[model samples]
Target: MSTMTRTPELHPAANLPTRVSLADTLSQTMTMAWRAMLKMRRNFEQFFDVTLQPLLFTAMFAVIFGGAVSGDVSSYLPILIPGLIAQTVMTACVATGVQLREDMDKGVFDRFRVLPISRIAPLAGPMVADTLRYAIAATLTFATGIAMGYRPGGGVVGLTGAIVLAVFTGWSLAWVFTWFGTVGKSAQIVQGYSLMVMFPLTFLSNAFVPASTLPDWLQTFVKLNPVSHVVSAVRSLANEGTITAEVGWSVLALAIVVAIFAPLSVRSFKRKI
Candidate 1:
């Protein structure tokens, strides 16, 4: 008789290295972005949210609150349109975290974890696709305003710049939500936190009303709010056709937000696995 010994089996995954090259990182980002775009195309309801919500809100605000707030729809168009754009675009970013959370819950990221792609690809890729939603929301907002007899003094080029600014702000803000999405236990909780933060920043600022109308203490805060600076910058660009310090400050603040939250988000995602 002869004695026999058996060796333990090695898992397939154990053989795959996690690191990827710089060339692979860029390719992975593009590939992941395309996947996100394809998924959005297949999901028609998302397209509806991106398009219809802004149009309806613009009309509703012009109809219901226009007269109360600014004495008439026509009179209110200038301030109201920019305010609506800012509100819609910023709130649009909240969806990023919600969708990110939903994807995480569904184990989409677990699949990514096994891939030899950069960790950033799974995060930044969907964000690249989400920019389309931001564009749709912003473009529809201006179109709605135009259809309702509103005109931007900034002309086509200036309005274009305003849209660019709105998209930039939306993208930068999405990074913060990305952090929340990676660490959040659920989509609802992430959205809840986003709302708790955004509602005050959007409403308490000069978005819907004149800062002068707010009480002294509240007005002080509104004037200081970075959201207010962004709004003022957009208004200056679209309503007045001027470049101002507000744009500079908005860019600076947005850069600071990304600088702080982006690394934290990447680190969290790395450790969670």
Candidate 2:
């Protein structure tokens, strides 16, 4: 009689315990994000580009507007400071999409797609890194503003709130850039398209000046521009030391924008991957 070799039965229960915990997943995502940050650090030029351009833009605006528009550097410093901060943070959002497109073009994402990681984690991880970029930009802009003699009447707490608001706005806007990155054909195209879209949203609003100063037809649009509310909110916090309905409404509007765009961006990212 031939002995029958019985193969050990595979147990489903044995496999169940092998699945990764959410904590482990999050740890892995953080590792990936850290790696991405390391890569950025090694590439010093790219890092400088992201960090320096915003600083130069802020300084240029301060000089141009200080001399030409306001004619009094000290007087305009207060108003221009908030506007520069708003513009810088808003512009920083475009880098998310442009970088995403660059990574995709370089097949960095293709490697990520093959890994056994959470789908949303890759997209989410880069966004986490981008927050650092936002922080850097906001800090530099604020420091430069102070150097130009712009004093925040709201004191330390109020100034802190303004920085937090700017960072939050940048984070919310990243979702919009993520969608563009996933869908756009090339990094250059993404940059061009994103600038075209963002320029009006930023400039047409009350970022630089009061909406009342705009023409009647443009004033209506500027008043409705979400950037106007954000600028107004920042101005209120930094200049007045008070939180008004404008701040509340601006926060709500940013929340709505994130609610609408973030999921769409994730879905698009999923499809692309």
lDDT of each: 0.85, 0.79
List residue ranges in candidate 1 displaced over 4 A.
Answer: 1-23
Highest lDDT scorer: 1
**Per-residue alpha-carbon lDDT of model 2 for 11-92, expressed as tens digits?**
6655544346788668777876797698778876545644786668767777777765577777777777777777777677
What is the C-alpha lDDT profile of model 1 across 1-273, one tens digit per residue? Answer: 998888989998888776888888788888888998999989977777668888888888889978988899988888888888878877878888888889888877886666667888887888888888888888898898989988889898889888888888888888988888888899999898888877988988998888998899999999999899999999999887888999999999999998998888888887766
Quote each prediction's TM-score.
0.90, 0.87
Colliding residue pairs in candidate 2: none
Can you give the lDDT of residue 78 in candidate 2?
75
Q: Kindly report the root-mean-square deviation of model 2 from the true structure over all alpha carbons.
A: 3.0
- Number of the top-ranking candidate, with TM-score as the measure: 1
Candidate 2, TM-score vs. the true structure? 0.87
Give the backbone clash total of model 1: 0
